[model samples]
Target: MLAEADNGAELAASMAELKAYLRIESDGEDAVLAGLLRSAAALCEQFVGQWLIRRGARETVPADGRWHRLAARPVVAIGAVAAVDDAGAVTPLPVEAYAIDIDASGDGWVRAVRPGNRLAVEYQAGMATDLNGVAEPLRQGIMRLAAEHFVARGDEGAAPPAVVSALWRPWRRMRLS
Candidate 1:
C-alpha cells in the first residue's frame, strides 16, 4: 500500500488561490472550501497516480530476486529501508544493501542486494514541493475539480470533466503490459 508521508507540507493549492479561481466573494464558506480543496487534491492524485506535494511514502514489497519496483512516481528521494522481523519489529537496512534509481523518466526503481523476506522502503515523492512549484496545468486541474465538487455536492457523474482529464493527461502514468 502506498500511503502519504507525514512530512507536514501543505497541499499544492491554497484556499486563497482556490477562492480566486472560484470567484467566491466572501469568507463565509472558507472552511467548507478548504475541505473541498483537500478532497479534490486527493482525487486528482488518485487519478494521475502521483502526489502533487512533497510527502513521505512507505512501500513494503516482498523480495523477488534482487530488485523491486517502487510504486509512487516522481520520487524525490529515498529515506530509509528496513527488514521486518517475524514479530514485525523493523531494523534499518544499511544503505549499501540497496540501490535507488530516480531516472529522468520519473519512474523510481529500487534493488535489494541482500534480499529479505519483506522489505519496507521509505521515500519522498511528489511533483512539487509547494503550490509555487506546481505546474500551471496541474494547479488549474485541481481548481476545476474542486469547483465541480463544490457545485455538485457529491453528485456522481458518468465521467470526469474533460478539462480535468485533459490538464492531467500528460502526468498520468501509462500502464505497461
Candidate 2:
C-alpha cells in the first residue's frame, strides 16, 4: 500500500501547484474556478501514479513504459531514467504524460500531454480505451481527493459526476492537433 502520508502530500502539493498555475495562466477567466479544475486534473495524475506504485509496480519502463510529470501541470511523477534507451540496444518508451481539458463549464476532461521537441515522436497508446476505463473511477477519485482538500480547507460541496459529466461533455469531444 502507498504510504498515506506520502500520497497525501503528493496530492496536496499537486493541487496547490495547479491552483497556482491557473491563477497565473488563466486569461481573464475566473482564476479561482480554473484553478479548481487544474487542481482536480493534477490530483488525478497523482492518483494514477500513486495507485500503480501502491500496486507494486517494479518499473514503468518503456515498452512497459510509465506516465509521469517531468514538470508542470499534472504532477504525477512515476518511474525513472532507466526507461530511457541509449540506442537500439533498447527502445525507451517516451514517457507518457497527463493532461486535463476542462470546458468553460465545470466538467473535467483528460488527454495525454507528454512533451517532446522532435515532431516525429509521439506517445501512442490506447487513450480512448484508457479514458473510457478510467473516467468513472477517476471522477470518484477526484471527488475523494476534493473532499479531503475541502474538509482540510473548510470549503463546501464535493463535485458530482452529473455536474462533472455535463461540464466535461464539451471537452470530451475536443480534438487535439
Candidate 3:
C-alpha cells in the first residue's frame, strides 16, 4: 500500500496560488477553491499516471524469482527492503541484496539476487511535492484544469480538458507489456 509521508497535507497548488489563478477577490470561496485545487491535482496525477506530489509508499510484493516493478511512478528513493517469512517475521535485507533500476519515465524496479516468498519495499515516489518542484508547463496545466473545474462548478463530468492531457503527455508512463 502507498502512504504519503505528509498524509497529503501539502498540495501542488496553494490556496493563494489557486485564488490568484482563479482570479478570486473574495475569501468566501477560499475553502471551496482549496478543495477544487486538490481535486484537480489528484485528477491530473491520475491522468498523467504519476504522482505530482511527493508521497512515501510501502509495498509488499510476492517474489516472482526476478525483477519486481514498483506500483508507483517517478520513484525518488528506495528506503529499505525486507524479507517476510511465513510466520510474518521481517528481516531487513542489506543494500547489496538488490539492485535498484529506473526507466526514463521514472518507473523503478528492484532486482533481487535471492528471491524470497515476499519482499517489502519502502520508497518515495512523485513528480514533485510543491509548486517549485513542478514544471512550468505542468503548473500551468494544473491551473487551467482547476480554472475549468471552478468555472464548471462541479457541473461537468469527469472528462478532463485537452490542454491538461497535452501538458502531461510527455511525462506519462508507457507500458510495454
Candidate 4:
C-alpha cells in the first residue's frame, strides 16, 4: 500500500510559481498549467526512480533470515514492521526484533531477527516533504519541463527537451541487475 501526505498548499504554490515563470498573469490557463505541472512532476519522478514528494509506503517481503531491500529510497522513517500469517493476521514486531539499514545512496533494507513467512514494512520516503523543500535543480526542472509542455501543447508527438533530463540525471538512482 502507498499513500501521499497532504501537499495541496505546496502544490498550489508551485503552480503559482510556474505561472510566474511563464509570465502568465491570468488564471485563464490555470487548469491546463496545473495538469502540465503534474505531468512534469510525474516524469521527473519516473526519471529519478524515487518519490520526489513525501509519502507512506508499505512493502511486503519474505522473512527468510535474509536482508530484503525496500522499494522506496531516501526513507525518512520506518513507522512499523509486522509479520503476516497465511490467514491474513498481522502481528506487530518490536523495533529490536529487526534491523534497518540505509546506505549512503539512500537505499533501505530490513532483516528480521527470527525468520517468518512474510513481513510488512511501513515507511515514509522521498527527497522532500513538500515542493518548496525539493532540491532547486529538481524544482526548476519541473517548471521548465512544464513550460515546455505548455508551449508544445498541441504538438502531440514532441518529446520532452533534453534540458529536463540534464537537470535530473545527477539524482537518478541506478539499479544493478
Candidate scoring better on lDDT of 2 and 4: 4
- lDDT score of residue 93 within candidate 1: 81
**Clash list (residue pairs), candidate 4:** none
- How many steric clashes does model 4 contain? 0
Local accuracy of candidate 4 as per-residue lDDT tens digits, 74-152: 8878778998888878999988888888887777888888988888888888888788889999999999999999998
lDDT of 2 at 126: 15
Best by lDDT: 4
Model 1 lDDT-worst window of ten:
4-13
Residue by residue across 58-176, what tens digits does model 1's lDDT show? 88877554666688877889888887767888888888877778888677777777766777889988888875677889878878887887888767763558999899888888657
- By TM-score, the candidates rank as 4, 1, 3, 2
> By the TM-score metric, which is better: model 1 or model 2?
1
Each prediction's TM-score versus the true structure:
0.86, 0.26, 0.85, 0.91
- Stretches of candidate 2 off by over 4 Å are 1-30, 50-120, 124-133, 154-177
Each candidate structure's count of clashing pairs: 1, 5, 0, 0
Candidate 3 TM-score to native? 0.85
The model with the greatest TM-score is 4
RMSD score of candidate 2 (Å) = 15.0
Clash total of candidate 1:
1
User: Clash pairs of candidate 2?
Assistant: 60-65, 61-65, 62-93, 107-167, 107-168
Tell me the tens digit of each residue's lDDT in model 2 across 17-130: 344533445445344343454466554554333221121122222222223212111223233222224443423333344343333322223333544321112221111222
Give residue 128's lDDT in candidate 4 (0 to 100): 86
